[model samples]
Target: MKRALVIGASQSLGSHLATRLASNGWQVVGTGRRPASEVPGSEGFAYERLDLSDPEEAHRFLEGAGSDAYDLVVHNAVTYGAIPGKPPALDELEAMFRVNALVPYRLLHGVLAAQPTDRFCSCVVVNSDSIYHATKQSAPYAATKAALRVLTTSLADTFRSAQVSVATLLLGPLPDPRKLADFQRVAERHDVPVEDVKRAFLRKANPFYVIDDLIGFDACYRSVEYLAGLGPAGNGMVCRLDGGSAGSLI
Candidate 1:
């Protein structure tokens, strides 16, 4: 049986990916900020508590998780918010970078250290198109994700001969219910109608929004599965699933 570890499996796209993997007959282990009781119907897979904001705890979790020798690992955890026209505070910036950039860097190293010398492991990082197309007031979040994309690319080279592969699945918007609240909040803060927000989002220049037709959770799940299915040496390559809009990555 193929075993996989999914980082940040608590909500949004992460939660969707975890459930899909479990249903597909994979022994899936996932991480969240709290215990499994917080997740509804978590019986299909196992859970590990992880708080990426705490560096020491994150390292420990990655080390322990790596020792399990998972065939695949999917990283989908992120923390960020946007307040237009204002710079983020130092603490918030630090937290965003830690989760988006630093954690993934350490995760790769820890997993590599723990795996058997000859075993192959595939890693997929869910990345945003924000790196190529920055949105209003999302500088900190965009910068960190850009760092993660670069870091994932660099690690692929470091592990080339170790039979390990790492790939970045650059993604666009999906119809996640949770993000409705975020859209509402941003709209309220900006004192604009929600339609204005939606209009701005329809612009292919924005990183988070895609065409309405391609905005579903299933597309994201299938994209991730396809990335994980690629053979070795597919490492460092980028696969974009941003609803057919190249978003300048092409």
Candidate 2:
């Protein structure tokens, strides 16, 4: 069986992706902040605890996972928050950037530097269109993604000689129940009506939204599987999956 490493496989898209890959015959190893039992559908895969904010923990986790054991690595871990007034504190900024931007770089460097001559590896970084079109509330999140996009492109060039393919998938907002619940919680915390938050989301997301622009879990799984199947052909490719809106290769 082909070995695959999936970062941030505890919940949401990551959880779904891990489960799907396992069902399809990939020997999957997943990482998450929560315990293995807390993560749904983790029976057939290995789960490691990783808290990106804790440098020591993060380092040890990656070190143990190694760099070249897996044929594919999918980075889906993320930290999200929106500040209302002034920019986030230095510590907050650093942590978010470390998780979203730096971690992916580390994974790439490790994989490309150690891959065996006879094997090929593919690295996929889950990105957001917010990197291109940012809203007021998405500054920190968008900045991290924008930085990651450039890092991925640069690394793709650097690793081509090693027969390692690196790609960025710019994904649009998916209609997830947990995400909607988080939005509701945010609205409650700010003392704003839920409808207000919903409206803001609709307006900010309109430019990139399709008529029915909700991305489902299956679509995400298919996209990653397709990219992984590309083997040596998709080196340095950047693709966008914005549901019904627009899909392209950049």
TM-score, one value per model: 0.85, 0.85
Considering summed lDDT, which 10 consecutive residues are worst modelled in model 1?
A: 205-214
Per-residue CA lDDT of candidate 1, range 1-250, in tens? 8888888887777878888899999899888897788764467888888888788887787667757887788888887754657888888788889888998788766876576666678888888877766755777888999999889988888887776788898887665665567668879999998766755756634544446543567877887777777858567778887765554354
lDDT for model 1, on a 0 to 1 scale?
A: 0.77
Every candidate's CA RMSD: 3.7, 4.0
Cα lDDT tens digits, model 2, 127-239, are 88777667667888899999998898888888888867888877888767776897799899999987677657755575546534456678888888888889877777776
Best by lDDT: 2
Model 2 ranges with Cα > 4 A deviation: 82-86, 182-204, 243-250
